[model samples]
Target: MRNIKMTIEYDGSRYLGWQKLGDSDKTIQGKIENILSEMTKTTSDIIGSGRTDAGTHARGQIANFKTTSNMELIAMRDHLNTYLPRDIVVKKLEEVPERFHARYNATGKQYSYYVWNTPVPSAFERTYSYHHPEQLDVTKMNEACKILTGTHDFIGFSSLKKTKKSTVRTIKEITIHKEGDLLHFTFIGDGFLYKMIRIIMGTLLEIGIGKMSPEHIDTLFESGIRSDAGMTVPAQGLFLDEVFY
Candidate 1:
C-alpha cells in the first residue's frame, strides 16, 4: 500500500462541509472518497487536516489516503478532477511516508475571513464575503486583533458546547487589513476550536463598530463566557487558506 498526499481546492458553496456524514452524500470528503473507492476497488478513507463549516471555501486544504492501487500520482489526480464536481478539484498529489497522517501530522493552519465594508453590497461577492454596511474603524479592529494573538484558552470564542479536549490554543498571528471596500482578516494558529475564527471575527467587527472595546477581549479570556465574546459570523466569509506541517 502507498500513502498519497493530496492538496484540494474547492468553492464549497454547495457542499455539506468537509466531513463525511452518514445521512448525506453532499460532502467534500464523501465525494472524493466515493471516487477513489470506485477507482481503486476498495474503501478509501481520506483524512483532512481539519473540518470547515458548511458553505465555507478552501484554497489549500490538505488531505491524504492510503491505497493498494499502484496508479501514478498524475493519473490519479487527473481522474479525481474529472469525476468530482466542478466545485471541488484535486490540485496536487504525491506519495508520502507511511506515517504521514494528514490530521495528526498537521502543525498549523491559516484561515482568512472577508467582510464587505462598503454601504452597497457586492453582487458578485455575496457568496464569498460578509456584508457589513456600517462604517468600521479599521484601526480599532487591529487593536482588537493584537489582543487576540498569542496563546490563550479560547473556549469563549468557540461554538463548542463542551469537550474534554483542550480549548487552549496558540494563535501565532491575527491581522486585519483593508483593501478598497473589503476588510480582510487573517489568522495563523497552532489549532482552533469549532467556530473559533468566525466568533473572533465577529468580536473584531464589534470592536470596529465601537460596540465593544478591545479591552473586553481580556475579560472574555478570564471569564470564558461564550455569550460575552461575540456573534458567530456567517460561514460564507470564512476560508481555509492553508495547512502547514
Candidate 2:
C-alpha cells in the first residue's frame, strides 16, 4: 500500500463538518472518501489531522489515506478535484512514507478568526466573518491575550460536558490585526479543545468592550466552569489555517 498525504481547503457553509457520520453523508471526509472509494475500487479510510466543527472553514486541513493503486500523484489529485464539489478542493496531494500518520504526527496547528468591526455589516462577508457593532478596544484585548497564552487548563473555555482526557492546552501566541473594518485574530497552539477558540474569542471581545476584565481570565482558569467563561462565538468566523508536523 502507498500512503498519500493531502492538503484540503473547503467552504464550510453547507457541509456538516469534517468528520464522517453514520447518519449523514454531508461531510468533508465523507465526500472525499466516497470519491476515493470509487476511484480506487476499495474502502479507503482517511485519517485527518483534527476535526473542524460544523460550519467551520479550513484553508490547510491535512489528511492521509493508504491505497494499493499505482495511480500517479498528480492524476490522483486532478481526478479527486474534478469530481469533488466546487466548494471543496484538494489543494495538494503526494506520496509519503508508510508510517507517516497525519493525526499522530501533527505537532501543532494555526487557526484564524475574522471579525467585522464596523456597525454596518458587509453583504459579501456575512458568511466569512463575525459582525460586531460595538467598538472594540484592541489594546485591552491584547492584554487579555497575554493572560490566555501559555499552558493552562481550558476546560472552562470548551463546550465538552465530560472527558477522561486532560483539558490542558498550550496557546503559543494570540494576535489581533486591524485592517479597515476587519479584525483578524490568529492563534498558534499545540492543540485546542472543543469550541475553545470561539469561547476565548468571545471572552477577548467582551474584554475589548469593557464587559469583562483581563484579570478575570485567571479566575476562569481556576474555576474550570464553562458557564463562567464567555459565550461560544459563531462557527462561521473560525478557520483551521494550517496543521504543523
Candidate 3:
C-alpha cells in the first residue's frame, strides 16, 4: 500500500463545496473520489486538509489518500484531470509517509478574501470578488486587522453556537493590501472556527465604510457576542490559499 498526497485547485463557482454531499453530485470531493475509486478498483477515501464553504475557491488545497494499487503518481494525476470537470484540476501529486494525515498533521493555513472596491462594475471580477460600490477607508480596515491578529477566543466571530472543540485560536498575522480598485485581505492562522474568517472580513469591511468603529473589535472580543461582531460575508470572495504542515 502507498500513501499519496495531492494538491488541488478549483474555481468552486459551480460546485457545492469541498465536502461530499449526499444531496448533490457537484462537489469537489465527490468528483475526485469517483475518479480515484475507478482507478484503484477499491474504496478510496480521501482526507482533505480542511473544508471550504459553498462557492468558496481553493488555490492549493491538500488531501491524502491511502491506496493498495501501485499506480504511478504522474499517471494518476493525468488520469484524474482527464475525467474530472474542467473547473477542477490536480496541481501536484506525490507519495508521502504512511503516518502523514492531511487534516491532523496540518500546522497552519492561509486564507484570502478579495474585494473590488470601485464604483465601476467589473465583469471579470464578478465571480471572484466582492463588489463594494461605496467608498472604503483602507487605513481603517488595517487598524481593525491589527486588533484582530492574536490568540483569542473567537466565539464572537463564528456562526456556530456550540461545540466541544475550542474556539480559542491563534491568528499568526493578517496583511491587507490595496492596489487601484482591488483590495486583498490575507490571514495566516493556526486554525479557524466555523465562518470565522468571513465574519472577521465583514466586520473589517464595516469599519472601512465607517459603519463600525475600529474600537468595536475590542468590544466584540470582550463581549464574545456573535451578533456584535459583524455580518457573515458571502462565501464567493473567500479562498483557501495554502495549507502548511
Candidate 4:
C-alpha cells in the first residue's frame, strides 16, 4: 500500500464543509472519495488536515489516503480531476511515507479573514469577503492583536459549550494588513477550537470601531470567560490558508 498526499483548493460557497456526513449531504471529502472509489474499485477514505465549517473556503487544504492501486501520480491526479466537481480541485498529488498522518502530524495552520471596509458593494468579492460599511481604525485593531500573541487559554473564543477540557493553544503570529478598501487578518496557530478565529476577529473589530477598549483584551486571557470575548464573525469571510507539517 502507498500513502498519497493531495493539496486541494475549493470554493466553499456551494458545499457543506469538508467532512462527509450522511448520504443526503454533499461534502468535499465525500466528492473526493466517490471519485477515488470509482477509479480504484475499492473502499477509500480521504482524511483531511482539518474540518472547515460550511461556507468556509480553503486555498491549500491537505489530505492523505492509503491506496493499493498501482496508478502513477500523474494518472491519479488526472483521473480524480475528471470526476471531481468544478468548485473543488486537486492542485497536486504525491506519494508520502506511510508514517505521515495529515491531521495528527500537522505542525501549524494559517487562516485569513477578509473584509471589504467600504460602502460600495463589490459584485465579484461579495461571496468571498465580508462587507463592513463603517470605517475601522486599523491601528487600534493592530494594538489589540498584541494581546492575542503567545500561548493562552482560549476558552473565551471557542463556541463549544459542552467542552470540558482546557482550551489552551498557542498563537504564533497575528497580522492585520490593509490595502485600499480590503482588510486582511491573518492568524498562524498551533491549533484552534471551533470559531476561535472568527471570535478573535470580532473582538478586534469591536476594538477598531471604538466599541471596546484595547486594554480590555487582556481580560479574555485572565478570566477565560466566553462573555469577555467578542461576537463570532460569519464563517464566509474565513479561509483555511494552509496546513504546515
Candidate 5:
C-alpha cells in the first residue's frame, strides 16, 4: 500500500462539515471518500489533519490515506476532481512514506477570520464574511489579540464540556488588519480546541464594541471558565488557511 497525501480547498457553505456524519451524507469528507472509493474500487478511509466546523471554509486543508491502487498521483487527482463537486478541489497530490499521517504528523496550523464591518451590505461578499454593522475599535481589538497570544489554558475559549487531553496550547501569534470596510484576523498555533477560534473572535468583537474590556481576556484565562468568555461567533467567517507538517 502507498500512503497518499493531498492538499484540498473547499467552499464549506453547502456541506455539514469536514467530518463524515452518521446522520447526513452532505459532508466534505464523505464526498471525497465516495469518489475515491469508486475510483480505487475499494473502501477508502481518509485521515484529515482536523475538522472544520460547518460553513467554515478551507484554503489548504490536508489529508492522507493508504491505497493499493497502481494509479499515478496526478491521474488520481484529476480523476477525483472530475467526479467531486465543483466547490471542492484537490490542490496537490503525492505519495509519501508508509508511516506518514495527515493528523498525527501535523506540527502547527493557521486560521483566518474575515469580517465585513459596514452598514451597507456587500452584495458579493456577504456569504463569505461576517457582517458587523457597528463601528469597531481596531486598537482595542489588537490589544485583545496580543493578550490572547502565547501559551495558555484555552479551556475558557473552547466549547468542549470536558476532555482528558490537555487544553493548554501555544499560540505563536495573532494579528489584526483592516482594508476598506473589512477586518481580518489571523491566528497561528500549535493546535486549537473545539470552537476556540470562534469564541476568541467573539470576545474580540465584544471588546471592539466596548461591551467587554481587554482585561476581560485576562480574567477568562485565569478563571478557565467557558461562560466567562465571549459568544461563539458563526462559522462562516472562519477558514482553515494552512496546516503545517
Candidate 6:
C-alpha cells in the first residue's frame, strides 16, 4: 500500500464544510473522495488534519489517503485538480509512510482571521473577509491579544454547547497585524474548541471599538462564562492557514 499525502486549498464559499455528512450535503472531503474514487477505480478514505466550519476557507490544509495505483505525484495532483470543483484544488501531493495519520499526528494548527477596516464594500473580497465600517483601535486589540497567549481554561471563548470534558487549551502564540485597510489576527495553538477563535476575535473587536476594555479580558477569563465574551464572528472570515505535524 502506498500512502499519499496532499496539500489542499479551497475557497469554502459554497460547501457545507470539510466533513462528509448526509447525502444531501456537499462537502470538501466528500468531493475529494468522489474524485479519488473515480480516478483510481476504487473507493478510498481521505483523512484531513482538521475540519473547517461551513463558509470557512483553507490555504494549506493537509490530508492523506492510501492507494495502490502507481500514479506519479505530479500526475495525481493534476488529475485530481481536473476532477475537483472550482472552489477546491490539490496544491501538492507526496508519498508518505503508511503509519502517518493526518489528525492524530498533528502537533499544531495556525488560523487567520481577516477584517476589512473600511466603509467601502469590496465586491471580490466580500466572501472572504469581514467588513467593519467603524474605526478599530489596533493598539487596544493587540493589548487584548496579550491576555490570550498562554495555557488557560478558555470556557468563556468556547461555544456553550460544547460537551467536552475539558475546556483547557494552550495557545502558543497570538499575533495581530495590519496593512492598508486589512487587519489580520493569527492564532497558533495545540488545539481549539468549536468557535473559540471566532469568539476571541469578536471579543477583541469589541475592545477595538471601545465597547469593552482590554482589562475586561481578564474578567472574562475569570468568569468562565460564555456570555462574558463577544459575539462569534462569521465563519467566512476565518481560514485554516496551516496544519503542522
Best by lDDT: 2
Better of 1 and 2 by lDDT: 2
* Candidate 5 structure lDDT: 0.93
lDDT of 1 by residue, 48-145 (tens): 99899899999999999999998999999999999999999999998999999999999999999999998999998899999999999988888888
Give every collision pair in model 3: none
Model 6 misplaced regions, further than 4 Å: 160-164
Error of 6 at 240 (Å): 0.8
lDDT of 5 at 22: 75
Candidate 6, residues 108-217, lDDT tens digits: the string is: 99999999889997887799889988999998988888888899989889885656588888999999888778888899999898899999999999999999999998
Residue 239 of model 5: what lDDT?
91
2-22 per-residue lDDT for model 4 (tens digits): 999999999999888999987
When summed lDDT is taken over every stretch of 10 residues in candidate 5, the lowest stretch is 20-29
Q: Give the local distance difference test score of model 6.
A: 0.91
Answer with 3 or 6, whichever has the higher TM-score: 3
Query: lDDT of candidate 2?
Result: 0.95
Could you tell me how far off, in angstroms, the CA of residue 5 lies in candidate 5 after the best superposition? Answer: 0.5
TM-score of 1: 0.98
Clashes in model 5: which pairs? none
Alpha-carbon lDDT, every model: 0.93, 0.95, 0.92, 0.89, 0.93, 0.91
What candidate 2 gets wrong by more than 4 Å, as runs, is none
TM-score of each: 0.98, 0.98, 0.98, 0.97, 0.97, 0.96
Off by over 4 Å in 1: none
Using lDDT, rank the candidates from best to worst.
Answer: 2, 5, 1, 3, 6, 4
Weakest lDDT window of 10 consecutive positions for candidate 3: 176-185
Candidate 2 C-alpha lDDT tens digits along 23-107 = 4879999999999999999999999999999999999999999999999999999999999999999999988999999999999
How big is the positional error of residue 131 in model 5, measured in Å on the Cα after superposition?
Answer: 0.4
Using TM-score as the yardstick, the better of models 1 and 4 is: 1
